[model samples]
Target: MRLYNRDWTRREIEERVGRIDQIGGIQRVRGAEGVEDGVELVRIRTGAGLSFDVIPSRGLDIGMSEFGGVPVGWLAPGGVAHPAYYDAQGEEWLRTAAGGLLMTCGLMNVGNPSEDGGISYGLHGRVHHLPARHVGVEGSWDGDEYEMAVKGTVDETSIFGDHLRLTREIRSRLGENVIRIRDKVENVGYTRAAHMLLYHFNFGFPLMDEHTKIDFPEATLSPREADMQVDGYDSWQSPEKGYDERVYYHRNIRSEDRASVRIRNDRFPAPSGAALPISVELSWDAATLPNLIQWKMPGQGTHVLGLEPANCVVEGRAAERERGTLVFLEPGESRHYELELKVNPGVTAP
Candidate 1:
């Protein structure tokens, strides 16, 4: 296995460490306090300077993530609150959004709040706030390669309403600064159900600042609001007070099978006292996730850059239905989505 920039045999590495976990492994923990009480957390550590937390109690979504002791994921002020605090009404979902590394946005709806078929739908969706069952976590070696993974199933179903089940698996290697998320959404009920999915990948400072640059394949960019159409769509700035959030939809992404968006910062101070060019790339299956949403909000106390990939836009389910863009899943039907997030510790600034 490769660790700390060198190849080593199991015997040699084991001799130097008291326990394998001291180098890299998985540990299960529980949040104990106020909003985070009783939250189950699966902490993963890769010897290659990558670490993250996976919350099974919160739809098996990823929370804090770091590379080389530097935060690669943006954290909301309230932190990872317990799912019990989730409010599924109108805009109240933001209270417990917990803006983490990855937030799974849907099953029945994704976007604004609205009324559909005499039923009121909330802001994003209930998927992120749903608890997972049959959660599993493991770390094993596969012929010189150490692999760590966590799996869970989250169901969004009522008595006779939508019965959608999302089976998610998040995996990483011992010597890699990468995380791969695989999800399968299935309509397990007898009737057809509406489906909308989005993966919200948020990035914040000091990884995102004025020196950061975003790169992606050529695509048609459409601002969510007409007045939001301005310059600097590929650059960033420091946190500004009272700055309004701007969202843009990228359509017709030019990629063969998958599309990737990269954010790079040229002047990130490393733990080694060096200014390293840090880069993080998010890639997804373009065929399944056909659209990308760029959420630029460099506002004070809310500074974040959201690189979201989804099947539907954030304009809400009703608007999607009206535009003939809503997706539906029939009984026993399933859809698969794949995503990878990789961190490059050192890169030549372009």
Candidate 2:
């Protein structure tokens, strides 16, 4: 297995993005087309008996998100919007500029068409859709399932390359609910692009109800002190709400690997008719990647929770380092990041 890198030598990954034609002749329901969004979706059943709803959010060129469901969490749009929902306006700066205020951006629709409204900010990270050229696939397939790899790149002009190189490949195997997301990022320029932040990964779906429960081990969490609730509509905002009006910032975080965190998702509350979902895990075994974020926002209007696994924590990469949690890479240096979504279904009538 040759470890791929982030550099000009990388191939175009976009060529590989397409529908999965299963050998078993499994049928999938094509998602309704959104006239303006130009989003394409394919439901693929991996050899492992697990399935996934894969959508190529056409416009945002180079990027994609995978989970058992679509659009995972709250991504403030890129340009502008309600103050509570997004940080819309921002400026570019690394060592000098203040943290970019991310607001609503070119929002993508996922989940049921009629009610699709969640947003992913950092505009899904500028890399999400960077006019990818597309590379070829590597990896083999067994009788049950197979693996395919794709690559893409983009160039940003500056005195220094201040440009970025990114790579993400997915592994779909049999008998596993987990799909592995492998990524690499290289700062190909001179000045450090610190003062950075990545919030684009957000997951929401069957778990977007008040009955949903979010659980994690947090013995050393320091809550973001706020006397008032940020959201007024959420019935979940009352003081009785366990996690309302506050963001738990955890230190002394424990994980199977420091590169990533273990598990984060909204589980169905008991007394519901909905089926139980398997566990989803995002692990970062590489450098560059740090902090595993689990954000549950049951504010009045919107209902969803986000399990964000970022290369750097909130306030961006520099902020994490300022607080003594993130690592820095030199020019041309890179880090390998991987995420595993273990979808273990519970026993049911066959």
Best model number under TM-score? 1
lDDT, candidates in the order shown: 0.90, 0.36
User: Residue by residue across 5-94, what tens digits does model 2's lDDT show?
Assistant: 222111222233343343211232333432213333334444333444333232112122223333333332231111122222232211
Deviation in angstroms for 55 in model 2?
5.6
TM-score of 1: 0.98
Tell me each candidate's TM-score: 0.98, 0.57
Task: Show the lowest summed lDDT stretch of 10 residues, model 1.
Answer: 341-350
Global Cα lDDT for candidate 1: 0.90
Task: Please give the range of 10 consecutive residues that has the lowest summed lDDT in model 2.
Answer: 96-105
How far does residue 37 in candidate 1 sit from its true spot (Å)? 1.0
- Predicted candidate 1 versus true structure: per-residue lDDT over 1-350, tens digit per residue: 87778898777877899987988899999999989999999999998988999999899998998887888889999889999999999988899998889988988889899788888889989999999999989998777788899998999999968899999999999888889999999999999899999998899888888999999667888999988855888899988989988999998888889999999888887888788987888999999999999999999989999999999999999999999999999999999999999888787354
